[model samples]
Target chain A: MKNTILIMGHKSPDTDSICAAIAYAELKKTLGFDAKPVRLGKLNRETKYILGYFKIEEPELVTKIIEPQSEDMKQDIILVDHNEKTQTIDEADNANIIEVIDHHRIVFNTANPLYYRAEPVGSTSTIVAKIYKENGITPTKEMAGLMLSAILSDTVIFKSPTCTEEDINIAKELEKIAEVSIETYGKDMIIAGASIEGEDLADVVKTDIKLFEFGTKRLLVSQVTTAGVNKLLETKNQIIEVLEKIMKEENVDGVVLMLTDIVLEGSELLSVGKYASLIGVGFNAKVGADSVFLPGVLSRKKQIIPKLTEILI
Target chain B: MKNTILIMGHKSPDTDSICAAIAYAELKKTLGFDAKPVRLGKLNRETKYILGYFKIEEPELVTKIIEPQSEDMKQDIILVDHNEKTQTIDEADNANIIEVIDHHRIVFNTANPLYYRAEPVGSTSTIVAKIYKENGITPTKEMAGLMLSAILSDTVIFKSPTCTEEDINIAKELEKIAEVSIETYGKDMIIAGASIEGEDLADVVKTDIKLFEFGTKRLLVSQVTTAGVNKLLETKNQIIEVLEKIMKEENVDGVVLMLTDIVLEGSELLSVGKYASLIGVGFNAKVGADSVFLPGVLSRKKQIIPKLTEILI
Candidate 1:
């Protein structure tokens, strides 16, 4: 009732998503607006490293939300993801998403009149950087450094397909303010987050889950991740098939799964699509002898969405 | 000689610049290559936020390299910016650049031999996300989230003038691997960075500097900072006159400076141009107004470059 705004992001909160949500909320507050940051899934090891870097505490993990999409979302409940990208929602001058921030390809079925922008950079934190710019705001050195670190972690030092030059520039600027070396710091951060000693696999997946809706054909895009590479590939198909059955029973459109080989720099995209070819062609997957093989596919957001949009559209 | 790579960023180092250097170096090392990230200019607060987010230290700041820009850059010199989009140096197979990454609008520059990609996102860290997606590539969750955070920071949570939808989506996806909350965490990062106490006003300007080249002329663009809006506006004209003299004394074609009031969400763009009218049109500044009154202009890379380019071209 206090003009509450839900700051949400994608599932599986990363540094970009987490930092964007937090920065955006702060910006709104500075602009005299009430906003709360929410996450769709749990935090990961790398995100923890970023949080630790800034000496900020991480948010709690959230498994379920009231709705799948933010569009036409019930005023009673707001759906927020870790990536902080809003998909759909009705626009209202007041209390209707005043802004939606993200760094992924745009995909929303909403009739909301709101301020929205999505860039081609590696992370949503890049978008947050602009928010500070928009408000004539400059982040504290520590804050800037943390956001810069988030960009480096997601963009892979700008080597991945998803990176852009702006990301690199912004990171550099923030680095100066933060007074730290990103290359050396990034290595230390990665080493810090490498431990997956004791955790529930399902819990990890649920922590960063996203609910997708295509014309009421609901689907759950659950990104399951493991620390090792070969282990994920070995049982990739089995995991997909099982997830597919689970989705079908739940009256969902399909289950699109990712078997990520983090070390090899590729992903095994498995889907139970009623129209597999359509989805496959959309994703630019190899017309495999059996299952679809996305060579050099590292990101579901960058690789799969483009193809999926083509198919879905 | 030992395959050393010098990583360079745009004139002003932002979150993407800082993170790309670190993440890319890590990826190269994983691929069994020698790489080092370098900052073209001094870093800023946002970059510090990102580094802190990932718990990674910052890279050494390099104001300039004695080496010149060339197609025959050695492996020791990696010229990386945060604005290369569409095509990248990776297209060339013969050049020793070996790899390139960025997050700004695409450029028309010729490609060099290297592995590269330019996304439409706002930060270079988005590219780092793909590196994590590689097979057998296992960056720490903190590293992954660090990249994601950097993207959001650079893109202003996908709200900047240069943001795209793809950037938002990729950031969302990276959240899973990074395990960060976009809203709260990002807010913390920025807040930490916004506190600029004990900062040298001159130091802020000297770092993260960009150069503008016009027809038969050149301009050095830099930003000076103040704690509040009062000091910034008070010293606007004095700063401009001083910069103009310095520009002439240095024998440079032009000098444009920004008196950024981080708290007020505005900037006073000051410049001394031979073609004052052209510069005015380029910056949308008024005649005799002294400095351009820009509401919410924080990023020289994102806010100023494109507009200036339009006027220059």
Candidate 2:
């Protein structure tokens, strides 16, 4: 008998990772596989709201999937999340993983026996969208909503440079399936997620942060979204100061802070040290004494990465 | 004098295109422009069904919008149907179409001055989705339902290759707003649109037939969807025979008949010509006497064109 497999993604389980696991499980069922949708962490308010809109119960949180990606057939586990707790294949108790898929830069290591796929794309939801498209599986609105939500969350409402035409197309398909106006949902979700009243300045800068290595110099990119750009503008200096300390602590070459105005279709870019001029020149932005201002840079992923990479490297 | 602008695509006024036009018009109003959404052709039963489901009336048919995108102006107009009858654009218009935006590959050169945009992505609705995204606009559930309906109709429930990530994302968003399941709604809509019993075989195929030109070859790709592929499968040869005649009469390089089985997640690719093998080879597909079984193939735009172009060129 095949054992039950709990499919999941990173902690804070954004829409794409959550929905991909669910849709894939549904597809696995169609293809005669035993799988279940699992989340590694608690759902955020926006995710909860979208799920409630679709009347879908929140998927159970599975701390870890036993056998993750590869073929040791050994009961090794791969840990994921900011806190990074350990989990192993023996704990998942599944005979085989069948498949492990994600869009993040592949941080986990696992020992498993089965199929797995990973690619560097805008969102994991795009990968799942392709799977459903290639399988001829018509997604339910709940799944579509989840996928759309994931894309919005990951792409930061297409602000992230991670978004592609494929991501946009998948978002479009999911929009019809989920039956929500993405722009409306995206704006609302961004607004809901952007409550920065009492959060730590460091926490705000670290919220959905990613690190990149360019040559000998390391780069830290942090993205924060608000309903409007005013909040970030208000806390601009504090954020820059916090990032400076974190950079020193992390021993990073350069650090950048991006405050996305979800409703305003642009972002304010703050940079420290040697990277400021590079980013400023590449983005054709307004250069200040300590930072650069991007007039139309709402999405950190889409707007910053390409230009920064061009200049940094 | 205020000018009248009519917005439409093909015959059916779907959710994205329809709602986008409405939302854009609303945005235009905020920006000091007058616009209205207009349907060029009559809506099928599915459009009517979804509209009834959402308790909204169908938009008036504009027959054609005389305005063009180049002028960057808005207008009021009269409505007309396929029968060439007319009404005041205000009295007959379904939604306000200030600018014409589409994603279908078919380029237009109309009698009216048209402000048109067509992107080679999945659905015209996706373009509308972007308008709302660009303007920070929010749509009501009823409006979201209209956009989702358009997307479902145009994308063939996300099976249409024309579907993009944006389309899927929007579909998901719309699903929540419309309070309907994407899969269930898709099944119902496909069934509603799947009436081959009374349709003239040739006429059915002729209606909404898409033409593609590659090198010296012009391929005629006709799509007809049915709930069950089996019944259509029974009439396949007959449909093929009619398609062959149509292809010959139209003087095209080749003919491909796509009998889309929406629920089944596959397409029966029937081609009649020396070029049939060209498509088979391009897609790495299995070929019969005059056909190929395209597994996991859905959209006519996404799947067929890329494959066909590679082989023919």
TM-score of 1: 0.40
Off by over 4 Å in 2: A30-32, A42-45, A64-96, A102-121, A133-136, A156-162, A273-287, A296-303, A309-313, B1-313
Model 2 score (lDDT): 0.63
Estimate, for each residue in A1-313, the C-alpha lDDT of model 2 and write its tens digit: 4346556666656566566667666766776767677787767656676677777878786664455354444332222111112322224553333444555332222231222334456676677776677556888777778778878877778766666777788788788888889988777766777776666778767756788877777889987777767756776677778988989988888788787776676677777767777777676665555555566676655567767777888
Q: What CAPRI class is candidate 2?
A: incorrect
lDDT values for all models: 0.60, 0.63
How many pairs of residues collide in each model?
223, 82
lDDT of model 1, residue B200: 54
lDDT of 1 by residue, B203-294 (tens): 55555456767565677888654336565556566556667666777677777777665445567777776755677766776765656768
lDDT for position B256 in model 1: 76
| Interface RMSD, one decimal, each candidate | 12.9, 21.3
Please name the candidate that would achieve the greatest TM-score relative to the true structure: 2
Candidate 1 chain B least-lDDT 10 residues: B106-115
